[model samples]
Target: MENSHASPGLLKQANSSALHRALREKGAATRAQLAAATGVSVTTVRALLEEMLRDGEVERTGLGASSGGRRAAQYSLRRDKYYGAAVCITDGQAHGLLVDVHGEIVRAVPLKAGADGLRTPVLAFLDGLFAQRDIRSIGLGLPGVVREGCFWHADKEGGLHSVAVEPALSRRYGVPVVLENDVNAAAIGFARCYETEFPGEDPAETNMAYLHFDRGCVSAGFVAGGRVIRGCGHFAGELGLVPTADGRLLDECLNDPQDGREYTARVLEAAVWVCGILNPRYIALGGPALRRECIGPVNDGLSALLPGPMCPELLYTADIWGDYQIGMAWLTAEKIFHMVQIIKK
Candidate 1:
């Protein structure tokens, strides 16, 4: 009898998980829409939605356009019910933002110097933000590599090398913490921004790459089939390490921009190599050195390097910083949702 009951319970949990994920990906949906999206019966979807409504996890947000007789009710995750904290650590400063479940920033604190210095201010900011609300998870975007939520290295001295960042923060805050490379976070954020900006275009089904050129050095982050490719050791996109024909590193040539044509040539050379390798749907140019003036030359160089049919669209991401923070927030929200699923199981 207990085993018989357990089978149904497990089925219900699976259906619930499917429904929750559908709602999350779609942002908001009607009961019928959720049913179709999840491939679950309307009856089951309604039951799960009711449970979510009662738990304050879901809320009705007006009505959808009438498909036939009457307008259907729309449901959305309760944006204010939960929040996440996002921190981006750079060479000298850490930037933090408080984001709601809907991936909107509620508050942003001033930048602080050093990881240790960032701890006090960021924690205090989160403490104040969580004073009246619940923060589900925290995500940190470091300037260097991360593995299994552990800090590896950063560009600057006195970085995350010696600290057990994720565990320490998770223990301190009593919530899950995710650590990722800053460029990777920016790539995730860029994907989110693309989805938001172009609702009709699905980034999940596409291949995209974000190339970050910072202080003459370059690194790349790739997204294939909606997932970030971190590679075996989480060092997938270390493009800067690739040397040039002259036996000099890519960064060496990029740093010495005395000759405009030479600078353009080097940039184009790297871009061409990336295109040949990934053949991505699009490549976004980011980081400090990708200025407005450089775009024209880069485009010209690209035009000369590859034929029109083989060339991928090149775009300059102007909001890498903002996107990095938002990506961290989205990652934190995903962690929270996964935790909820685990608890239910």
Candidate 2:
């Protein structure tokens, strides 16, 4: 199926991408180390490193420890070569961070939103960052249903209802813009952190559901096969809309629990739905209402409803804001790298 004429170019691009990714993971490495990691010949690795250095995409850090003879030159992705701006709109505030190609935060810009909506604060924050750094792409995380990079639906209290955030941002910044649901972003962030903590496990085995209960409402985000499982129409994690047994919405029962027992029952119902369908490896429970005492009962209730193998480990995730920002940074960096690969093509 391979075309002999085009194979060489495609192979070169693939090898180049592998080298860059290895550097991103290793921070800096010599030609021989890169070749060994990427399974590319030493001569080909040297040529690609020279090309990247000439293009200013990579830089020489210094000489590495000599293995047998002379010290090999070390190479790394240029820290200032590309930047991605990740912004999260929540609680009448816009939090933004300037992330580099290595997924490190270059700068953080947090601002209070105005009455006009998140648009004002988001624009002002981005304008300030763009004035100083050349941002390659933008990632926006919103608490709502996002369909094809558009904010389709949110509670009327949220000012960003029915707004097309992605294209509007792309037009203003003249770069790729990604819009993702807040919970979904948090799920990806949780998965990444989990993998980092337990590096021995295969990342592809990361399947999880992150549930957030706040202000009398609950929603969920799912990650399967190391990717966010945004189903058709992008309404996959809208758990609050799911109905309950007594002919009322799930949020209705959650909004008005009589006692701690009833509250635990309501949460158990939600977990049952998540386990019965997704059967993820973990169900990360978080938000304001999630208490340490309630997790035990929720887990016990889930086990009673499903078989041992079907039940997922329930984890309490604090610091939703932190997870959201990390997720946005990861996504923005991925977009920038994808753009670089497209340019090569």
Alpha carbon deviation, residue 319, candidate 2 (Å): 0.5
Per-residue alpha-carbon lDDT of model 1 for 42-98, expressed as tens digits?
998998899999999899998988868899999999987888887787766777778
Candidate 1 Cα outliers beyond 4 Å, as residue runs: 1-10, 114-116, 154-162, 307-309, 339-345
Judging by TM-score against the true structure, name the best candidate.
1
Candidate 2 weakest lDDT stretch, 10 residues: 336-345
Clashes of 1: 0
Model 2 Cα lDDT, one tens digit per residue, 1-345: 122233666777777777877888778999989999878799999999899999999999999997789898899999898899999866566788899987766777777767887777778888988898878888888877888767876566864457777888888889888888888988888877887888886666788999998787788899878778888878798888898877788888888845888778878888898888888999999988665578999999988889988899889889888788888888887666542132233
Estimate the TM-score of every prediction. 0.88, 0.86
Candidate 1, which ten residues in sequence have the lowest lDDT sum?
336-345
Local error of candidate 1 at residue 184 (angstroms): 0.9
